[model samples]
Target: MHDPERFGAAGPAAPTAVAAGCTSTPRRLHHHDQQAYVWSRVHVNPSPSGVPGEAAQSLVPPPRSGAASVVVQDKLYVFGGYGGGTGRLDDFYAFDFRTCSWEEVQVLSEEKPGCRENNGVVVLSARDQSIILFGGYNGHRWLNDLWKFDIATQRWICLEESSPDMVNAMVNEEDETNAAGMGMPQQVVNASTTSQRPSCRFGYVSVVYDNKLVLWGGFDGQRWLNDMYVYDFGSSLWSQVQQCGTLPSIRSCPASAAEGKYLYIQGGYDGLERKEDFFVCSLDTYTWTQMPNLGRTPSPRYFHSCVMHSNKLFMYGGYSGSQRLGDMFAYDFETNHWSEVDCSSGDSPGGRSSLIAQVHENNLYIFAGYNGQTVLNDMYKCRLRPIGIPSPSLLNDFRRLINDPETADVCFLVEGREVHAHKAILAARSQYFRAMLFNGHMRESSDNSPVEIRDVSHPVFCKVLEYLYTDTVCDATLEVGIHLMVASELFMLDRLKSICEDLIRGEISTENVINILVASHQHNALGLKEIALDFILQHLSDAKIQGGLTELKSEPDLLIEILKLSSLQPVTPFARRLGNATQHQVLSPGTEQQPSQAQQVRLFNAHPAPQEQQPLWRVDWR
Candidate 1:
C-alpha cells in the first residue's frame, strides 16, 4: 500500500511506527459449502480470575446483551457486553464451532478497557493480527475510545489519544513484508479537530468494506441519528457523506448485513413503534433506497439477527410489541421475495433479541442475548437445509388410509383374521388379485366382502399390504419371509417374490440350506431354488457333512441330477479350501469351523481372483 507518507516515517515527537514480526495474511473466503454446526467449545478452567470483569465468571459466560462478536475461520470472538444485573463486563471469550466449546481469553496486560455494549469489533488484516474496537456503552455513559487488541501478544492498545492517527493507523498501515509479523513500537497520530469527528455514541453500525472502516448511525443519548460517516485510511479523516434517495429515520439497533457493495438494513424501533420495513444503502454512491416488500414480510420488531448467505438475507428471532418471536425468514435479493425458514425440527436459538449472529462457512452462528425474561450466554448453530422431505406422520397417515373402511373397497380373511384393504392397491400389485377382482373370476368381488387367503397368516398379509403402501418391509425375519414368499408366489406378485427371495438367500446357511431348498422346490421359486443349489455346490463336502446329502438321498431324482453333473466334472473336491486354515494358523482358545473360506472351489485359487458366486439353477437335461 502507498501509505508511506502517513505510516512509514515518524519523528520522536510523533507516536513512531516501528515494525513487529507479526503480520496476518488475508485469505480467500467463500460461503457456498457449509457443514453442520455440531461441535462446541469449553473452557478448561472454570475458576474466576476474581478481577473486576472476571469475578463470578464460570465455564459459562455471564448473561449479557449488545455484545461485540465477529466470525473468523469458523471461530467466533465475543467481547464485553452489558450483563443485565451484573453491570458492564470486560471478559473476552471465544466460541469455536468446530470444537463446540468456549474458552475465556483473559488479556494479560492491564491496558484493556472495561466491559461495554454496542461497541464495534472487526477483524483487521494488518501485518500483525489485531481486532479493532470502537465506541460502546458502559451502563452509565457512552464511550468513543478506540482499542486495538494484538492477537499474538494478547494485549490491548488503547487508541484514545488522536483520532487522526488512529484512523491513519487503521486504514493506512502497510503490510511489513521485511519484518517478522508482530506489532510496531508505536503509531504516529495527527489531530482531527479540523473536520468534524463522529460524536460520542453507542448502538451504532460499523462495517469493513474494501479495507475501509465505515461508521454510521447511533444512539447519542440525546437523539437517535440518521447521519453517515466514512473513514478514509489514506487521507486519515472522518467525512460525512450526502445522501440522494429516501432514507430511514433516526433509529438504533437495526440489523445491517453487507453483500458486495450494498448494506441491507431491516427492522428496528423508532421510539414509538417497531419497524418491519427493509432498506438497502449503496456504499459507492451513499444513497438510501427502501426495499419493496415482495415476500412474507416479518412483523415489526427490533433487536433481531440478520445475515447474508448465497444471495439471501436471513432474519431470525426478535421482540415485537406484545411478545417475543421464535420464527425466522429469508429474503432473496435476486428474487425480491421472502420465505420462512423452518427451524422447527432442530435446535433453534429461540425467541431472542439483542443477540449477535455472524455468517462463516455457510453456517449461521448466533451467540447469547436477552430472551425477554433474562440474559443468555448460550450459542446455537443451525445447518442450512435446501430440501424438504415428508414427515413421519405423513407415512403413518398413508398407512391409516388402508384401514379406513370408507376408503377400502375390499376385505381379506387370512388365518381367521379379517383385514380391510383397498382393491385398487391389491389389484395393482398382484396379477392374481387383478384377475380375480377386475376380471370377475371371484364372487367376493361383486359383494365387496372378505375373501379367504389360503396358506397366508394375518401378520404376513399385513406386511404384504404395508409394502404395497410404503415399499418398505418392517421388522423382517426368516419365518415371515418364508411365509411371504409362499403367499407372493401364490398371488403372482413378482416384486414381493424377489424381496422374499433376497431375504431367504441372506439367511442361507449350512443349518438352514436344506429347509430353504425344500421350500423353494415346493413353491417353484426359481430364484431361491437357484441360490440354494449354488450354496450346496460351493460347500459340496460341507453340504454333505451338514446333511444336504441325507436330504438328497431321500430324492432319487435330485441324486441322479447331482450324479450326472459329477460325471461331467469327475472331481468336485471344492479345491479352494475347507474348514482348516490354509494360511498362517493362529490357534485360539475355541475350535470353531471356518465357514467363510468355503465360498467356492476355484480350480485355480489365485492370490487375486474375481469374487464370483456360483449359481445353483444351472440344470441340464440330455
Candidate 2:
C-alpha cells in the first residue's frame, strides 16, 4: 500500500509567504534571522552613489498609480497616470533601479502626449534606446495616441498623428484625486495605415512577438474586440491578421508573453467576468490552442503582468474578482507545468494590479500599481534565486521513477517497448494488476521473466504505469485521455479512469461531444456518458449555433443509443418524443408535460453496467 506519510500525499502543506518591498531596522531577532536569509538570496538593494549601502533612500517620482513604465539603458522611464492635483497630468520621469534614485528629466519637446494608465509600453530599442508607448486611459477617457521617448535626448516625440500637447500639465500633488473616466474626449484620428489602427482601447493585451508588436483583445468604449493587429517597426505599418481556430473571448487586461514562435495568454477580465483560462497562438499556424494547467495555479485575475526570462514565464501581481493579489507564479514551457513562487524574505510590493514588471539582468523591476484602493509609486526589485522553500514534489519523484526506476520485479513489454513498475505500487493502485501480479494468477511467461502485454499500444500502456506511480497522466490530450480511459476501464482502475473522464469532460463541446459519448458508452463509463449527454442537451442552443448538431443524424450508433435509452422508459407529458428530423430534432412535447430538452435528456435513465457484465479480467491467453 502507498504510505501517505512517506509520500507526503495527504495534502499540500502551504509554504510561508515571503516578504517584499523596502524595510529598515530589524524589529526583533526573529526578523534579523529573516534578514540573514535574505542576504543569502540574490535580491540586493543597491545604494545611491553617495549614500551608504544600508541606508533607506528616497526615489520619489510623482505619486501616481496605474502609470506605464519601461526600462531603457538601465534607466526606468515612467509615463503619465492619474495625478491628484492635476486632472490627468502628462509628465515623464525616469528612475535607476540599480541605484535606487529618481530623475525627473526635462521634456525638451514642444509637445508631449497626454496622461494615461496601463499604457502599452515596449522597448523599441534595448541598446540604450527608445520605447514605444501606446493607448491607455486617463481618469475619464481612453487615449489612442502613440509616443516615442528618446533616451539620449530626453524628449518625447509623436510616432503617430499629433494630439493636443500637454507639456505643462503637471499636478502640484495638493488637489483632490482625479476620478477615472473624467476629463478630455481624447478624440482619435483616422490613422493612415494599411489595415487601420486598433480601436481606441484600454486593458488590451499587447506584446512583442516575431519582430512585430502584436495587439489583440481589448475593450473599446462600447464593446470588447477579439481582433488582432500587428505593427511592424521595419515597415511602419499595421495589419490585422486573420486569426483562426478557437479565438479567445473579448477581454482586457489579460497578461501575455512571446516565446519561440508562440504567444501565451493568461488571465484577464472581460468586463463582466474574470477569466483564468490559458491559451497559446502559434506564429507558424497562427492558430489558437487552449492548454490545461497541470496543478494548483493562480486564480482568475486581470491587470496582471507576464514577463519571460530564461524560457520561463513569470507572473506578477493582479486583481482577482474579490481582491488585489501579491502572489507570483512561474510556468515552465518545456515541462508544461505551473508552480507558485515563494520568496525567502524581503519587503514585497504587496498585492496590486495594473503594474509593470521589466526584467533586466535576471532581476525584475516592479513599478507603481493600484492595489484596489491606493495608487502607489514605489519601485521594488525582485532578485530571482533558487529559493529552497518546502513543498512535497511527488511529481518530481514520479519523474525520477520514469527516468531511473528502481525495485522493479516485473517488466511489461507492450508493442516492442519496455515499461518498468513495482508490483506493490501497481497492486495498491490497480485491481487488475493486483490480480495478475499478487493474486497468484499465472501468466504465459514465468514470474521471473518479462510479461508480454497485448492489445494496448505503448503510449497508452505508459499512461497506465504513470498512473500507478504518480497518479497522473503525464501528457494528457483528448486522444490520449480517451485511450487511457479505455485502458483504465480494462484494468479496473476507477480513479485513473475518472481522471481521464474529467479531462475529457473539460473539453466537451459540440464538435467533440458525440465522440466522447461514444467512448463513455463503449468503455462502460456511465458517469461520463451521462455528463456528455447532459452537456449537449443543457447547451443545445450553443451546439446548434456552432453546428454541433449538424452531424446528429449522420451517426447511426449515437442515434440508436439515444432511441434505445428513450425506448427503455415510458414517455410522459413532461417527457417529449425524440423526433429525428432531417435538420433539427423537434421534441414532441405532450400537452400534459412540457419539459425542456435539457430536462428531457436528464430523464433518460442510463443505468450503470450491471456487476456481472463488468469485465471479469479473466484472460486465458493460451
TM-score of each: 0.53, 0.49
Taking the tens digit of each residue's C-alpha lDDT, what string does model 2 give over 44-126? 23324454666554436555555776667777777776543343556777766555556566777665676666667766645
Give the per-residue Cα lDDT of candidate 2 at 244.
80
Instruction: Encode model 1's per-residue lDDT on 401-488: one tens digit a residue.
Output: 7656788888878788778888887787677878887887875567856887766677878888887776667788876777777777
Predicted model with the maximum TM-score: 1
Q: Give me candidate 2's TM-score against the actual structure.
A: 0.49
For all candidates in order, the CA lDDT equals 0.64, 0.63
The local lDDT score (0 to 100) that residue 315 gets in candidate 1 is 87
- Runs in model 2 deviating more than 4 A are 1-57, 84-89, 162-195, 387-622
